[model samples]
Target: MYGVSTYALHSLPLPAALEQIAELTDYVEVMDDGCHYIESAEPLLSYDLRYSIHAPSRSVNIASTLEPIREASVRVIEDCFSIAAEVDADVVVHPGYFAWAADRERAKRQFARSLAHLSAAAEERSVRYAVENMAWEFFFLQTPDELPLPDGAGFALDVGHAHIMGCLPAFLQVPIDHIHIHDNDGTADTHSAIGSGTIDFAAVMATVGQNGITPVIEVEGIDAVRSSISAIRPYL
Candidate 1:
């Protein structure tokens, strides 16, 4: 089955977004940011749809070299894990980035440490999570060579980000536990409708089918979400 992310209705309250998305698909990935930031599963309990959370990414960097910042980032995700546990949902997270070129090695070390902590916490809560590949430079795990995730972490493949980075084909080769599907020109992460951009959705849909994964339509607006669902329906 296919799913939709609340990101398309980010301008609305979480409940409102969920209400609209539920009408379109039985599965939804909550983009926990802005108006949709989830502090508890109480709001989610009302929905009948299956859930996967895109944990809060803004202002959260698990790879920060500063001890407090890195620790705080882990804590933020730990709280998300608590909510996921209550809902029996999986989560999607971004790999942290370094501020300067000189700090890349330090940031990687910090990220590894944070990942270890998160793995243990997730196990405790019985919630699974996948680390997503990023679109820009200075971010960790942007390529397949960065594989063999530390502490047995899972992977969430974002096709738009991978396309922007010019590595979608390589990322598609990796074992993906979760996926975010959207369209974009080869140069930017536009999160456009499925057929509105250059991405070869036929190949993407084929891989998703092979993996038996539900692809989350992570586009820009409610209209784009509808368009994406229509575009991918043929593949589904």
Candidate 2:
């Protein structure tokens, strides 16, 4: 099945974005953030849609060495997961970054501790949590080899980020349960429409098709979302 993330309509209010998404596709990954939030899930329950959530991460740093910051991050994400249960949604989360002034190794350990907590929390709620790869210069999970999640957790592979980092093939090597599909120039995470950038969606889709993995298009506009859907339709 194919879905579109509300990320494409991030500028719109949650209700309006959900309305548009309902018209475009039956599946939507509601990005729980500023313009889109889990609090708006009540309206979503009325729609015949399969839902997922891109957990809020703007100020959330699960890898922070400070105990308070890390705990706050977990609470924010857990709140998102709590809402996920009400709407029968899975969640995708950013793995986290090491504090710029902190010890990288120790921060990584802290990050792992956070993932373990989230993994148990997700299982308890009967929702799967998939950690996403980041495109930042010093974040964990930039590649598949960097272990981010414990057993019973999954990976949310962002194809655009992988292409920008020249790690699409490497990221594909990991076990993935969810995907964020979009395009970007090799230089940046522009979230362009499919075929508007250099990444090889054909090969990507071929692999996704064979594996029976569904992807949620994560572009930034309705036209881009529609274009991406058309571009990937042949494989489906």
Top TM-score model = 1
Error of 2 at 117 (Å): 0.8
**Candidate 2, residue 175: how far the Cα is off, in Å:** 1.7
Best by lDDT: 1
lDDT (tens digit, per residue) of candidate 2 on 48-150: 8999899998889998888899989998998888899889898999888875755798888888889888988888889888889888877888877775467
Model 2 C-alpha lDDT versus the unseen true structure: 0.86
State each model's CA lDDT, in order. 0.92, 0.86
Per-model clash counts, in order, read 0, 0
**lDDT, model 2, position 197:** 96
Encode model 1's per-residue lDDT on 69-111: one tens digit a residue.
Answer: 9999999999999999999999998889999999999999999
- Clashing pairs in model 2, backbone N/Cα/C closer than 3 A: none
Each prediction's TM-score versus the true structure: 0.98, 0.95
In model 1, the worst 10-residue window by lDDT is 135-144
Model 2 off-target regions past 4 Å?
none
In candidate 1, which residue pairs get closer than 3 Å at backbone N, Cα or C atoms, i.e. clash? none
